[model samples]
Target: MKKIKNKKIKLGISIGDLNGIGGEIALRTFEDERMLDFCTPIFFASAKTISFLLKHFDIDIKFQGIKTAAEALEGKVNIVNIFDDKAQIDFGVETKESGKYAIQSLKSAVKSLKMGEIDVLVTAPINKSNIQDDDFKFPGHTDYLNQELEGDSLMFMITESLKIGLLTDHVPVKDVAEKITVDLINKKYKTIYNTLLKDFGVEKPKIAFLGINPHVGDGGVIGQEDKEILIPTLEKIREKGDLAYGPYAADSFFGSGNYKNFDAIIAAYHDQGLIPFKTLSFGKGVNFTAGLDKIRTSPDHGTAFEIAGKGVADHNSFKEAVYTAISIFKKRKEFKKLTKDVLQKQKRRPASSRRGRFE
Candidate 1:
């Protein structure tokens, strides 16, 4: 496949929890010089943090530290320090200090993103519990991205074979059912549908919906949500000239190999979707926040505090996150070009020669 951006795309990296594996996996990802051939990476972190990781892990890679994205060099890992002396790294533990620094890194990268200084963003993991402050009251990264970018983003999990989108992310299990309304369902469906086509290059994407209750409510014995809410929602989606099917039992859908026939799956809640996805692609899945104006992706795993400084943290998912961000960036650009070309052609056609709207 072609590199996401023909002209070197600038990728912004946000350090997650400084106390965890965010810096370790991030630094490890760029260890090889060949990584720069595809895109320029700017780490939104402090020199103190990166240097600490380097010495702690005993890594020998050098990175360019710049004040702004404009100074990012081609074929080199760049660090845009967002914190200085106030920043501290405490490996294998989560602290308020780490959380504050994580937010700082994210805010810095977000500024660069808004200025159009970076093409894509690949975030490291953040401890949801620790990262919560007045500035970050949301549950996690997806919430922050949605609020900042002002888009109804979906927690779209991607692997080589399957893509799963969640209806309600980071919600309590008891509140999950109450959150599933027709409007929310339809909006999420539309976002996932458009993302599949524009960001993933999937034409006529097939979306499968998972039932909320066991055996799809067992014909109202288990629950009424499947028959009452989700079924009607899917019908409405299909009527809009889109291919969507299901309200299928989640367990059977994946086990029966039925998901392979679909382009994406829409799960009712967080665990309902992520559990299966992680089971299948645990070490290599990329969590992509779709429907936002800017591209943002992250490794499927969390901080992995237990193995923070061990230098044995698996970088597969993080690596794939970077690759996926690049791919989506390229696909979106191409989709826009195709759309513009089509519009231009329609405009160039003689008015009288054009057929009626229905025709």
Candidate 2:
């Protein structure tokens, strides 16, 4: 595959559930003219829908409408008209129509991302219940992207101060214990380890794993999964020279400020990690889907149906998601360049000289 140049990364924006606050937060984010300097945003939604939103919110911003992602212009909010017909604006109601339009926007944006028309994607919030159909059977965006994209997906929730990765996201609490197998641990650990190096530029990442049970199964008195499953797996991981630590008590891990000591934390399930992460960085965190060949991010919070179209939804998280995607995209390019140069140098070296150096 050909590499896209780093200058003015094409950021694809998917307008999530129409009835939700997806449109509002997206528009609010790009209203600042300075954001155009970092990337050219392409909103995969109809021009009519965007116009309705602008008028409803009483926000003054002009956008250039286009039929395809190729026609996107720099320094202007560009909308790729995915549909010509107007979508009904129900404010806070969850209808089948809203779900249908949400998936349409998402599908269009993902297509552009796969074709290399967009360098990265920053998705708005989607209602998981509403946006389900024959085409999209996955629980959430990460699952769908995992199938569409190249590598194993890790749902990484990040902020400047804290970073958390889920071992099993979108899985029920009852099923989380069974999903924490040796293979799953190794796959997730490797993904996060490499992501830290290539995506976040961490030289040697220190990762902590939160326990599935309370107080890490209370030293096997409470449960044996941590003692039997997690302990053995972590020991094997350590033997391989990875900086993996802990089946630490999830309850006290964050309150004790131990999270600051590590590069990232891997939680056994969804709520175990997100609960603490949102508590700490609620409106500022970015949900980054790591370990994939393509880059995708979303706001930490979900579609606020209660606050939808109220003009009071906070756009900071969505804004941070865009910034995070851009930063990671640039970092990945730099990593590829550095690695490519090293490979070329190694290829030029004599075999006898390389053997002597290893000796």
Candidate 3:
């Protein structure tokens, strides 16, 4: 990880579908002056689109248009125009033009992130179906980002009291069983474990693994994957010194309030994890992409096409996503400092010495 010298971090944002609630919530989050105290905001979108939304919503905030992210000023909302073409916004409608520009905004933000021009990336919701083409063929943001960073990314849904990670993201239920292999389990577990330790400041996190089938396949009566796959893989993980337990049945795990006992929980598929998470923390959950080289976060909800331009969409989840990204960024920096101290101390020791100490 590279050291950041500036106390005020720069937040890079991607405008999702222009027709959706992405632009609305982003403007709402930065409306408060208190937000400027934590980070400088730079949005990757067209100034014209923002102005159109401001007038449509009757919002009265002035935005500074900049040609590059480097020119962002303190306490000002800087908009980096990625596209020059004009696309009309049809409220509560889906169009190919919106998807095209959404991809452009995201691509620009990703390039800036790789160049170290931004500290963290906050993506708005995009229509998965409309955003697909030859170059973009992923199921969702997590898949696209993982490929871009060349890192194993986990879709971790976060709230004030809960954190849930998915083993199979944006996959069909019919194919979830075949994808839950030993190698897949090992890779996801390692990613989640390392992220918990380094990103979330958990020294030794206790994680729970929810079973795939109901009643854990009832010991092969319903299915045999749990007995053949999960039980044995969990044993191997435990042997490697990670605090992991469960093949717990999904129904009773959250229904009985047992999720509060662990630091994080992992599910077998997308809906298996997200359905419960959204139900419990609908308007306040933040989707944090863990295991990437740089920090990225988004609201747990998706593009609200039906409610677009209604001026009734909630900004609470998007606001929470910003707060979570800042918190994780600070935590990771602290972790790096602690590791650097240990390395420095070791370098000063005698050459003949053979000693080690655990923190």
Q: Which numbered prediction scores highest in lDDT against the true structure?
A: 2
Better of 1 and 2 by lDDT: 2
Q: How high a TM-score does candidate 2 get?
A: 0.95
lDDT of predicted model 2: 0.91
For residues 1-359, write the lDDT of model 2, one tens digit per residue.
99986568899999999899989999999888899999999999998999999998887788999888988998889999988689898989999889889999999999999999999999998889988888889898999999989999999999988999999999988988888988999889889999999999998899999998888998789888899989899999889777899989998899999999999999999999999999999999999999899999999988899999899999999999999999999999999998788778878998776521100
RMSD of each: 3.4, 3.6, 3.3
Q: List the residue pairs that clash in candidate 3.
A: none
Give candidate 1's TM-score. 0.94
The digit string of per-residue lDDT tens for model 3 on 1-359 reads 99977658999999999989998998889888789899999999878888888888887778899998888888888899877966689877889888988899998998898888888999999999889998899888888888888578999998868999988998878999999998988888888888888888888989999998898999999889999999899999888777899989998899899999998999999988999999999999999999888899999888999999999989999999999999999999998999889779888988678454222
* Candidate 2 deviant stretches above 4 angstroms: 1-6, 348-359
- Model 1 agreement with the true structure over 1-359: per-residue lDDT tens digits: 87784569999999899899988888888987788888999999877778888888887788898999878988888999778674767788889988988888998898888889998999999998998887789788998888888578899999979999999999999999899999999889889988998999887899999999998999889989888999988888788777899889987888888989999999999988998899989989999999998999999999999988888998889999999999999999999998888768879998877542110
TM-score of every candidate relative to the true structure: 0.94, 0.95, 0.94
Give per-residue lDDT, candidate 2, residue 78.
Answer: 95
Instruction: Mark the regions of model 1 whose C-alpha exceeds 4 Å error after superposition.
Output: 1-6, 349-359
